[model samples]
Target: MALIESQSDAIICINETLMDDELRSILEKLENEKDKEIFGLVCKRWLHLQSTERKKLAARAGPHMLSKMAARFTRLVELDLSQSTSRSFYPGVTDSDLSVIANGFKCLRVLSLHNCKGITDVGMLAIGNGLSLLQSLDVSYCRKLTDKGLSAVAEGCHDLHVLHLAGCRFVTDGSLKSLSKNCRNLEQLGLLGCSNITDIGLISLANGCQQIKFLDISKCSNVGDAGVSSISKASSSCLKTLKLLDCYKIGDESILSLATSCKDLETLIIGGCRDISDMSIKSLASECKKDLKNLRMDWCLNISDSSLSCILDQCRNLESLDIGCCEWVTDAAFQVIGTGEIGLSLKVLKVSNCPKITVTGIAILLDKCNYLEYLDVRSCPHITKGGCDEAGLQFPEYLKVNFTGNVVEPDVFL
Candidate 1:
């Protein structure tokens, strides 16, 4: 057999399993002024194929950034095109662009199109039309996506595990109901800012899904306590992490219900629920704090010393706590925390904006909570020089601190 003549660059690429498109972009970037002028004359298929596939290149490439991709990489496993700036940068490829990406990435396992404004139902349909191997999909901030698009995802992507639809306003309860019907294996579901989803949809979620481990319904304004209450009744053993921030419709009853039901929950974020008072959280602490490790009650103004007392006294396993803006909690909040054996597990504490807490308060925490690692005390305006001096007495051998929004760096205690 006669040996084939080849360019030096071509010889190296074949050994590396490199694609033609990726190689071409590098060549174009490296080519000199003279080679570019006469490079098109090198071969027939070379120049003809390059310029003719401009539309396809424009579909998945930045306008200013050179796209070398002529065909999708068949073995492509992960595709992340988050943010509208990158998606829109290429003067986005419309429906045809999506078809190209979808048809090309048939082996794609993870696809993230976070805030890709150019993608419509046309782009989503392309996924159904091609990629069946998708396991994780984040379509958060894709404002143009409608329920029709989500319906397609639910229908086609049955193996999806992680689905983030944050800020996808068009998604209604119907979309969630469909997801509950189809994606039974879903492990992580983030529906933040999905305003149309109410108890009707959430109830469907509980009925259809049994494997849910992480669920975020923050900014789901339509969801009331009744919806959460229903979830609380479900004896699902795997519900561990749940975030309900800005779920304005939920009152104290719903939170109480959830605390009662989700007994195994390790992390619970109920920030911005103005309707919740100490009574609600006290009940939660009483019921779930035994297993609770992380709790964020930030901006929960109604929480006072009694509620903090209940949590600090009962939730001994708490590793993280955010009691920001709960002004009613005075220095006395740490009184129970100083109990050597009871509150010993504290590791992370955020008491930002709690003006009532002074040096005496932090001194109790610094002395008792030996494992404290991360602390955020932004604008507590009350943590004066006296408080800093008290905090200086900390026994934190493995601690990092953020005090009053001023970085003292990670001062490890001996």
Candidate 2:
């Protein structure tokens, strides 16, 4: 009799545990997608709840599959259909597929269509007309996109916060003017490889979108000091990250203006800007010392030990530093970096192609930077493969060291 009573008690406990509130709590705790799927398979109610609650999905599918996905996940807020892989044989997503998505996913706030070559202005127009709540959009490397599609999006999605148009070669000032007229809430804008964009377009963007916090104009060859200076003046207090890589026309004047205006500046990438010298760097160190974290000045031939030393002494919160190809930077800068509390915070250090940095400097840096994760000393004239191998033995297991070349010894059979 007691055994039967115990069995009844166990069954009652199991029934109580599978109650609606308890099951929903279990579903909320599940972090893995596979686990959630398995949980939903337990009952019909679970399946219905999971379908209604799912908010994000990433899929590689055709028009029919996208239609099915939209029908099922109607509450989805984020969707990633990026065909970034080089699969030329597969027919990419088309305008009709985008039309299906826009009509179905009305609550979408983030959409990424990176490298979807088949999509053109027609698809963009559909998205603009439907996904009015979209705040972030990435169409990078969509080479067919001209100013018309982007203008349509800018007009409709006025709440856009992030827009990445990298490698959209056909985009011109007309798109920028449209964005200026709308998209007042734009915070992050990436125009990398948009060679047609000049100072005039940038001036319009800066004047209109004064709340921008992050901007990447890398490889925009037409951008000069005037455009950058305008951005610095307009988004002075809001700007945090600025990437001017390969913008040959950017000189000390624009950098000085940024240092004086953008007090909250954190990450600055000036690689390939050969015109920038120690003067601008020193001023930057003095003005944005507290907030400056990640700085890359690779190929800036004029920055020497003095500028490096100033950064090491002032920017205590710096985490990643890349001074590759700075011909004048020597062991003196490393020595200064190793002596103080600054080195403790550094996680990534790249001194590649610096002829003056030797094995001694590397040893000094490794000894102090206990948490260093990535060290790139490739092509340094004074650093040998043997020395790097020796240093690797002493470094933490997580640390990655990139040496000059791959030298594999031949197998010897005696």
Candidate 3:
């Protein structure tokens, strides 16, 4: 009788716990999509609750199938119909499908059609006309989208805050100018791999979108220092993240001007900007390094050990740093980093192709950076496999060290 009573009490306790509103709210706020999906499968009540509470949805289903499912989620705020896998078993989402989505999800603020190769200006037009409240849209790898479709979006979604047009090669300055004029509240804009975008388009965006916070002009070869200068002047205070990767035309003069103005910057990626030297980095460190969390300077050949010193001195809160293929990075730079306050905050470090960084410097770094979670030492010929294995043993279970191609013998000792 006692055991039966105890079992009943246990069941009742679980029921009470599951019914807790606070717990349910916490579960609803989960960042990971997979975890939330799994949580939805607990029971019919959970499934229904999760389905209704979910604001964002990314399903493999096509437009026709999604339209059927859309009716179930009356509160859907975001939708992603992009191909999630490298190879899709079904046909990619199309313009007719976007029309269906436009009809169903009226409350949607964000939509992503990344790699939906079949979608063109017609789909964008449908989206523009239907989703008036849309603030964020990503059409990355939708190579067919041109100024006509983008113009439609600008006219329709006047409240747009974020827009990604990566790999949309056909989009020109006209589309940018149109969006700038219409979507004045734009905060984040990505033009990655949009090679045709020139200074005129950049200037237009800067003049109109004063609230811009995140900007990625990577691979926009025609946009030089003049373009960056214009942008810096307009969105200096609001700008938080900037990516100039493969913008080979950009040099220290433009970078310095940006760094001096945008003091609130948190993440800066200047990979392949060969013209950036220690001067630009030092300037950046002096102005924004305190607040900066992530810095990637991959393949910037001009940046030497002094640049690292400048970073370590003031950029104490930095969480992730990548200086891969910076051949000038030596033991002196690592020595400073190993002993500095960065040791406490740095979680990820990439030093690949830095041949001068020896095992001794790495050992010091390992000893100091207790919170280090990832270390990439690939192509660093000086770091032996035996040394890396020893370091791996020293590191906690959570830390991952990549020492590929350095292995000489399987059983070699340091």
Candidate No. with top TM-score: 2
Deviation from native of the Cα of residue 35 in model 2, angstroms: 3.0
* Models sorted by lDDT, best on top: 2, 3, 1
In candidate 1, list every pair of residues with a backbone clash.
21-68, 63-90
Model 1 residue 95 lDDT? 54
Please report, as a residue range, the 10-residue window in candidate 1 with the lowest summed lDDT.
51-60
Instruction: Looking at model 2, report the run of 10 residues with the lowest lDDT sum.
Output: 405-414
lDDT (10s digit) by residue, model 2, range 308-388: 988987887888888989989888886676565545477888888999998888887777777788888889988976876
Which is superior by TM-score, 2 or 3?
2
TM-score of 1: 0.76
Per-residue accuracy of model 3 over 275-312 as CA lDDT, tens digit each: 99998899999888768988888899999999888896
Instruction: Please say which candidate is ahead in TM-score: 1 or 3.
Output: 3
Q: Compare the candidates by lDDT and give the number of the best one.
A: 2
Candidate 2 clash pair list: none
lDDT of 1 by residue, 243-319 (tens): 89878777789768867677778888888888889898888888887788888887787889999998998888988
